[model samples]
Target: MKNIILSATLLAMSAGAALADAHSVVRMGTEGAYPPYNFINDDGEVDGFERVLGDELCARAELTCEWVLNDWDSIIPNLTSGNYDTIIAGMSITDERDEVIDFTQNYIPPASSLFVALSEDADLEGGVIAAQTNTIQAGYIAETGATLLEFATPDETVAAVRNGEADAVFADGDFLLPIANEDADLMVVGDPVQLGGGVGMGLRETDTELREAFNAAIQSMKDDGTLNALIIEWFGEEAATF
Candidate 1:
């Protein structure tokens, strides 16, 4: 009789441990200040298009995900170090980036672009455009006989241009649109620069299973009305397509 009681207690403990391990949280990291993608709202909630998208992906994969906010440049390193399992920031899939991190299939298609002030002093008269460091947008604008100054992130570039520290800023069109719309002092102009690849959800090279699950979940959302409805609600019309 004692043996039977001991066995039952062991089984209960094992089951409890298994339940805890199964629900182990998956961490998501992002640049919390990048507007329209991931940003800290006045209420201190990390909310944006990417936030909603990441939550849906975690739900579809049957995982619990915790959102972590960090600066842009350090995001990938943190992921590689296992601080997080994934990144849902507005990260593009370029071969240069793929050399470092493994990306699930392109999740969002961004139109690369340049935006300058409406000031008569605005010199998009076909010169150099500045963009974030190592971004495809910088490379694209560099081809236009415009010298490209690579800043650390969009916020820096925007600040530079707004304060006359730089002539124009180049980046993802949709992201720039929101900022430009909010600040009358700035305006987005000129044709968008196109890059071939699509933006992707990032994961470490050892996380193929997680990547596959995320891709599958994204496809499922796309097939149903969930993805479309969310896109419209956030963008007020349609999500940008590549």
Candidate 2:
């Protein structure tokens, strides 16, 4: 998901970062609720594009890593608190977030942010719009003419639209397209809005060595065409690549 500009609470969260041992198991944190990115499969294991990509990165970096489930809203705070070593969730790189933590080069390129509603004619500019809290979409809506409704999770934003609590939901197109396709009641509305820089792995600012290791691994994948291949495998052939 795209990032939000830091609030006072977010600034506070970045004040302290837990020190990590270089040779220990690196814990990779993620919100396992987003599909094609990160999610818990039927087998109860973390599975998705990021799951596969993260493993490859660890191998290339020669780091021992383990996955940890985290809620999106607190993901950054948890990382600073030393709950995990890195955040490999679909977190977009943004200037405000960069003030709080470090990021590797983008894995996914910049993508569109779209709105989904029960009707194609939904008033995207002036209607009640739902978005996951602390995201760029939510931040955008608050600054627009639309009435913004914040939800704790992506699924809740979709639910608000379905139950008449919201006129539409604004979020990453990669995340909303499959929902619109499977649910006949929903449809994409309004012109796509591009926000944030791109999706990248987040690390505490102090983890420079870890950040550089992942950066090298990501660059290696890009150099050999494997990264582009994985992007297509999960997000389809049209997905943007390096």
Best by lDDT: 2
Task: Give the per-residue lDDT digits (tens) of candidate 1, residues 1-242.
Answer: 55554453444344334434544887888888777878888999899988998887776666678998767778888889988878888888888778889997766755556566656456664654668876677777666766777787788888888777778887877678778888888887766677747778888898766676676666666555576677667665746642
TM-scores of the models, in the given order? 0.82, 0.90
Candidate 2 clash total?
A: 1
Instruction: Give the clashing residue pairs of candidate 1, or none.
Output: 127-146, 128-146, 128-147
lDDT of 2 by residue, 87-181 (tens): 99999889989999999999999999999999988988889999998888999999999999999889999999999999999999989998998
Candidate 2 at 66: error in angstroms?
0.3
Total clashing pairs for each candidate: 3, 1
Q: Give Cα-based local distance difference scores for all models.
A: 0.73, 0.87
- In model 1, how large is the Cα lDDT of residue 17? 40
Off by over 4 Å in 1: 1-23, 125-128, 142-144
